[model samples]
Target: MAKATRWRNFTRSEAFSGYVLVSPTAIYAVLLLAAPLATIVAFSFFKDGYLTVIREFTLQNYVDTWSDPVFRAILLRSLFVSGMVTLTTVLIAFPIAYYISFNVSRSMKSRWLFLITIPFWTSYLIRVFLWKVILGYNGVINSTLDIVGLIDQPLNMLNNVQAIVVTLAHAYAPFAILPIFVALEKIDRALLEAGQDLGESRLMTFWRVTLPLAMPGVVAAVLIVFIPTIGDYVTPQLIGGGKVPMVANLIQARMLDLDNKPMGSAIAVSAMAIVTLVSLLFLFLNRRFLRVQK
Candidate 1:
């Protein structure tokens, strides 16, 4: 009876409730995320051959991955492409977010949000293919240009880095917009009024007050777009015509085509490290900016 009473009391406690609330997520992360990551890390230290992995430990995977010029070039290009996509997405998203948050009536906001999310209803691969059709030689753009007599031949728009960036930017626009809208909606209206009362113009008020308050959402949008884009194989493969290969494509080739799991794991680990470092740097800068604002 005493043990039962103590157990019941403990279960009723706030700390116990907190643990119960978080236990599901903790278990899910351990099972789904951490376990796979640990396996990949372990794989990175082993020797791999065609269709086989040796149990022997080696750092040669990492050494070879870094030393190869092709890998180095592809890694750098992947970072550049991801950065461009993030920038383009955020720039395009901000105006739409600002308008939706500030200009739209509350009753219509839901409808606006739904419209923004309409693209999600379609398959991602379908969207990529649609962009290919629009940009391809003798496709929509070229046909239109030809009809207008603007160009004598197809503009060579498809199968390039620019096409990949544009497609990715469009795909990630909704992700960027929602966070920024949330951030903008949370800003105190009184602050904007105060700025105006102090004789600031609308543009000045926005520059001094609105943009700073919205930085957190903008940062979130950047990370959301950048990380996955760096590892994206589909867009580059389909749009880049094998002319532009990102790190993820290289990893896939190593793992499947060459049957070298160790090299693929090493590349994946290195890419993760780079992304982690960049994310941490952005967070650190954001924190410092917040402190200075305070």
Candidate 2:
């Protein structure tokens, strides 16, 4: 009777209720995410064989992965492309978000948000292909230029890093905009009025107050864009025309085309490690900034 009463009391407690609520999600994450990640990590350490993983543990995959100059170049290119995409996306997103957050009335914000999300309703693949058509030789831009007598022949615009960046920035614009809009919306109106009342210029007030508070959203947008774009296979493969292979392309070639699963896994693991380190570094800096602000 006493034990039953104690158990009932424990179950009714706030902490127990919280754990119970979270248990399903925790279990789901362990099964879906943790299990697959562990398998990949295991595969990275094993030897590669024809159509099968060799039973022997070996570091040859890592050695080969690190020793190759091509892999290094691809890795650097992936990082550069992702960084550019993140920067461009954030820079473009901030103004649109600011307009919606500050200039638009509260009653119309939902409609504007819906408009912002309209692009997401379409297929991502279709968007990429559309950009390909736009940038291709003899395509819309080139034909327009030719008709306008701006050039004697079509300009070669497709299948390059710039094209890839442009496509990715367009694709990820919504992701960057939404978070920043949320951050901006959360800012107290009184704070702005306070700055103005203190005799600060509008630009000075924004520089000193608004941007600092919005750093969290900016960081979130950066991570959201950078991490996935770095490992993207489709944009670089299609838009880049295989001339500029990112890390994901290399991993795909290794695992599928080259029949080297272990090496691919090693490369994948290494990429995950780098991404984790970068994420942690960003989080640390964000925390430090918050502490200093406080």
Candidate 3:
């Protein structure tokens, strides 16, 4: 039959093979990513009983989350901290990325990149703890200052927002750098030569030509640093000394400590929503830059 033959032909096709190749990843995504998200979304709408999540649908969880002053302040603080980290990371990363892309020889570039990743050789937790040691009351800076007779008292460096920002900015610096470096590397050097030939100064040429071509990488770096830093629990907990808890810490407290799954789910959902919107905005900017690059 014609229909039977058509079905048989399709099964033998490359398109079918492509689908077969992709099916495992697709299945994994659905099971792990989509299912967890759906479960959280369902839990966020349910009511919280003493130690149990009531199946009854309610919007009160969201209402309570949004209405709480503490939650609002913490959420705003998370945003501010992430924005500051993103700004700081990108500003610092650009020069390093630029130096690697423009100044370093191709043979030496790999060595430079390897050195940049040297921090990742240690466990992330160990790195954070090391920061705590350096920033604590009697830590490196204060001890050195005291030894040098610079100060009588050890400075209170930890347990503050500034400390959180510093720790996070350092941890996520490489994430920002790699993408911008990739972007800078993609730019054609001949374009720079052409700009100079057209009577443009190096600074002006960079501002007009190099920077625009590199915007996609910078945008990628922003999303990379911004998203994870906003939801970060470890740096805020370990470095900020529990005093400057972010949304992740609050969600952990609500979910585990309080045994209020529904409330925790609501807070988690709200945080996800905020992150989603910000991510989309940057993704839009990335697309615009891509089109311009084209």
* Candidate 2 lDDT over residue span 1-294, tens digit each: 999999999999998989999999999999999999898889999998889999689998899989999888888888889989999999999999999999999899999999999999999999999998999986899999999899998988878999999999999999999999999999988998899999999998887788888887888898999899999989998888988899999999999998988899999998888888888997899888877766
- Position 78, candidate 2: lDDT: 86
Worst 10 residues of 1 by lDDT: 285-294
What C-alpha lDDT do the candidate models reach, one value each?
0.93, 0.91, 0.93
Backbone clashes in each candidate structure, one number apiece? Answer: 0, 0, 0
What lDDT does candidate 3 reach at residue 121? Answer: 93
lDDT of 2: 0.91
In the range 78-196, model 3's lDDT, one tens digit per residue, is 99999999999999999999999999999999999999999999988998999999999989999999999999999999999888888888898999999999999999999999999
- Model 3 off-target regions past 4 Å? 1-3, 283-294
User: By summed lDDT, which 10 consecutive residues of candidate 3 come out lowest?
Assistant: 285-294
Per-model TM-score, in order, reads 0.94, 0.93, 0.94
Clashing pairs in 3: none
Model 1 ranges off by over 4 Å: 1-8, 291-294
